[model samples]
Target: MNSMKALSVIFIFFLSLVTFSSGDLIEDVCGTSSDFKVCIDALRADPKRCSTDKKGLVRILLQQCSTKANSIYNEVASLLEQAKEHVLIQCLQICKENYDNAIDDATSAIKYFDANDFLAARTSTVAIASAPDTCEETFNEPPVRISPIKSKDDDFMNFIGLTMRDLIEDVCRTSSDFKVCIDALRADPKSSSADKKGLVHILLQQCLAKAKSIYNEIVSLLEQAKEHVLIQCLQVCKENYDSSIDDAETAIKDFDANDFPGAMSAVSDVVSAPDTCEETFNESVKISPIKSKDDDFMNFINLTASLINQFGN
Candidate 1:
């Protein structure tokens, strides 16, 4: 642990610049990774991300994978010891051997990484990533039985893959549109790299921007709103947007204070602005000039919320 801590500090100094905050560093690193959400989730899940640098991310990921690998190795061993069926025993034998190599490789990989041996670290990590494949295939051979440790294999793979691709594919899968969410995150490099808290920060900024823009537009519309009904509706909308902006600010403060529920409540408040605006127009002319814009902004807010739900996991 002491060695790891020392290595983490060295990683921060050497891999990340002093000018950037942890949030900035996370955005920059995740921005460059093949999987943004995976990287950010992995980093932001650990409170240490706020203090670490790029290589520190690698250290953290490697350590996580290594620990999981050890546990999986033990799990495989336990299964091997308990196997009664000849076929299952054979499969477990193969899995045990695979885990043996995997554990060794993981150990070497961390030592190599901490020592700044990039080539070796890459080699070991690649090995670790592929280590479970043989175990999986062994069970699928001949009569084709399922691997007892299939879930464990997959779990380790996801952790290891966080450095490369997304581990938490389910985050998007459960969403309204997985591809849309993925594209949205990937489209913005900083956003792609953001952890849960960081993502909320970005999403709220968008909400705030949308609110202010819509508010200004509402004010402008008031200038041309000749009909009494239209004028009244516009006034209501302006006030609604004003309330939303305040709530959004409150959400930001609550989020920073570690009050997640409070932040989400504030986020929920943002909905009333758009909903009430649309309803006000519907009650009168049944058509709002700002309906389309409000709808679009609302979609953005929902997407942000969906993403927040995923990252919160």
Candidate 2:
């Protein structure tokens, strides 16, 4: 028994050493200069400040910057937001340069996160990896006209189809505010007309199918959240009204001008819808008075989502 206890003690010591070492690695690589040193040092100075485990590194990094982290995180976020791998890689490199020792880890993360390829896959099956060096491939630039919309590429159509599936699954089935998510897609004026219309038609059909799930929770349990969903939908509708109307108008113009393909593409934009439900569902949780922060927010969301599925039907 004594030998077993001794072995256990040694094992624990080894584990603690590894844990502390990982924390050090995270801290050293996350920041530059003595400023970061101070933040990490605080963990040693006050046991209370440092987490007993190493999962707290991100929290510490955020705490160290406080308000500035928001901007930094935003920059990181925008890379994904606009689906700009080049800019994202630049930002990640900058992050590592600022925190040198973590360069390998950061690089590894960047290498693994093929955001360009991933987002591209979302829209089409041919994983057209974004050539980071291509000067014209920034997020603001139009999506590369890979092929005519009617091209016989099964993968491309599958890509758009899968994305629509996700938008329907993640958003349309969850809340009534799906219109908001669709608005983001519409902002890109260059998307093919058929693709846009097909995407929206899929979502609307899925929502109607899921409407039965939220029948009970629709009227009560989470009215604030319900209203928030409606508000998001209304807001998106308000913003897209002009654009959608314009797309329809443009489609007519293209058709009259005998631009069959262009008219179809234009028509797609006017008809396409994206799911905007998640944002409102999330926001409602933030302002909810009945539930404490620990009150199983995901479960609440699921419940409210069920309600939303039935709301408009």
Error of 2 at 215 (Å): 25
lDDT of 1 by residue, 1-313 (tens): 2211121122222233334554578767656555566666776777877777677766776676666677778888898788899999888888888888887887887898888886566557556655566788788799788888887665555444433224123344555566655655544434322344554576667778889999999999999889888899999999999999998888778777777777778888898899999999988865798999889877777766665555445
In Å, residue 53's CA in model 2 sits off its true spot by: 96
What is the C-alpha local distance difference test score of candidate 2? 0.33
Clashing pairs in 1: none
- Misplaced by over 4 Å in model 1 are 1-180, 309-313
| Every candidate's lDDT | 0.68, 0.33
Lowest lDDT sum, 10 consecutive residues, model 2, at 3-12
Q: What is the lDDT of residue 255 in candidate 2?
A: 48
Give the TM-scores of the predictions, in the order they appear: 0.46, 0.18
- Listed per candidate, the RMSD to the true structure in angstroms reads 17.1, 21.7
Error of 1 at 97 (Å): 45
Q: Tens digits of per-residue lDDT for model 2 on 194-258?
A: 23333343333333222222222232344444565454543543344345445555655554465
